[model samples]
Target: MGYEWLALAAAFLWAISSLISVTPARHLGPFSYSRWRMGCTAVMLTIMALIVGGWGSVSTAHVMPMVLSGLIGIFIGDTALFACMNRMGPRQAGLLFSCHAVFSAILGYWLFNETWHLAEIIGATLVFSGVVTAIFFGRKGSDNNDWEALHGKLAIGVALGLLAALCQALGGIIAKPVMQTDINPIAASAIRMITAFAAHSLFWASGAKLAKSKNPINRKIFSITALNGFLAMAVGMTLILYALQDGNVGMVALLSSTTPIMVLPLLWFITKQRPNHYAWFGAILAVIGTGLIVS
Candidate 1:
């Protein structure tokens, strides 16, 4: 499969996971949900690595990058993202999250000398434009353009969302050199998950953030959390590594940044209601832009 498909699959899988996750995230609080999810993923991936001989290829060199990737991307990035999604709905959060592509492109060029074409730039622009359109006009009522409807907490939420994007972008770039050496993407993802879980554990151990943890006791809720972790970390992050292995990092970010676009219809489906007019338009534009970039 092409990297574009991998990126798209990553986006869709994330969207599905997000749809399932928001409720638990709200109940457990973002950090708690993130920490536990990473823990689950760490265990699952560790088992996977043992099964697939991913451990044999590990080197001292790979360890640092994998850990850093996990810390930046999963620990910081996902924690902040879950908080942002809870503070602000996914609609606004998605638009802000698109900034990851720009951050990734700039960092990729500066750090790794990744280059882009005119067509790629155009496609990226369209993708962002579609995301904006969807977000601005896709809400249930006339309240579109979240950037315009700013308030005290909402503004903070937006900042958190942007921070999450930046971390995610940086994490992706940081892991690139290691992955380029032909490391198994699953192993790479698993290693990152372990490192991120370790980081989260340290944070919780500090006794300050423990107040934020809800400590899920319900088996069903725990199951949901595990499932989300498996989808996002096991499946989604692995696909992300696979995409970054050979795909233009910028294009991959832009293409996969369509999570918000995918989420609108998902929200409608879950809510049993029709999405707003602009959502459909934004979805189409995002698809067209992604297709163009691939072409």
Candidate 2:
């Protein structure tokens, strides 16, 4: 299949992984989950890189960018995302995380001197409007709820989601420059995973001591976390690398941002939490916007 198609597959897998992650995330703290997830991804990708002979071409010149990409995208991005999921629930968090495309587009333009067409701008605006509208209007609780209570964790979640988007955007831009060098994408991804694993380990070690006595890391959570990590690395990173190989960063980012659309249906089917009219409208708009931008 074409690189764009690969990217689309990657996005779909990521969406499925995200939906799967929510169940385990509910049981485990975001930090703990993120720690294990990154660790597993690091191991899995390392083995893949070695098996495919992708690691033989790695060099020092590619090290920093790859490491930084991992630190920003995997460590910070996933950690913030999990935190958002814990605070805002999956739907709201997913909507907010969709802003990653916009951030990535802007960053790609600034960093790579990529040009944006009017159609792209219009499409992105539509997607952003749809996602924000869904988030604001489709809240679960009643209006009488105090702003302090309703806003606290959810607001934090949104902010963190925005931060994660920015980090991912920056990391994507960083990865682009390095991809032009001698380093192969798979090896670069492996390097990134290593740094991410280290950072996550530090976080986990520091936090584990203070975790509540009843903290649970059962078989189900472990399995899901492992699956999430493996798919994210093996599929998500591979597709992203391929997309960057033949596509503009803005287009690739926008296309991949459709993941939430892929995910929402799974969430609805599994949980029976049907989205309201506004959410459905937003999802449609998002899909249209992504198509226009990518086209």
Best by TM-score: 1
lDDT of 2 by residue, 251-294 (tens): 67776766766765676687566656776787788777867765
Q: Give the number of the best model, judged by lDDT.
A: 1
Residue-by-residue lDDT tens digits, candidate 1, 136-239: 67774634533224434867898899999999999999898898886888889988998888888888888865436665547787899999999988989899
- The parts of candidate 1 lying over 4 Å away from their true place are 140-152
Worst 10 residues of 2 by lDDT: 142-151
The 0-to-1 C-alpha lDDT of every candidate, in the order given, reads 0.83, 0.73
What are the runs in model 2 whose C-alpha is more than 4 Å off?
1-3, 133-152, 207-214, 293-295
TM-score of each: 0.93, 0.86
Error of 1 at 117 (Å): 2.4
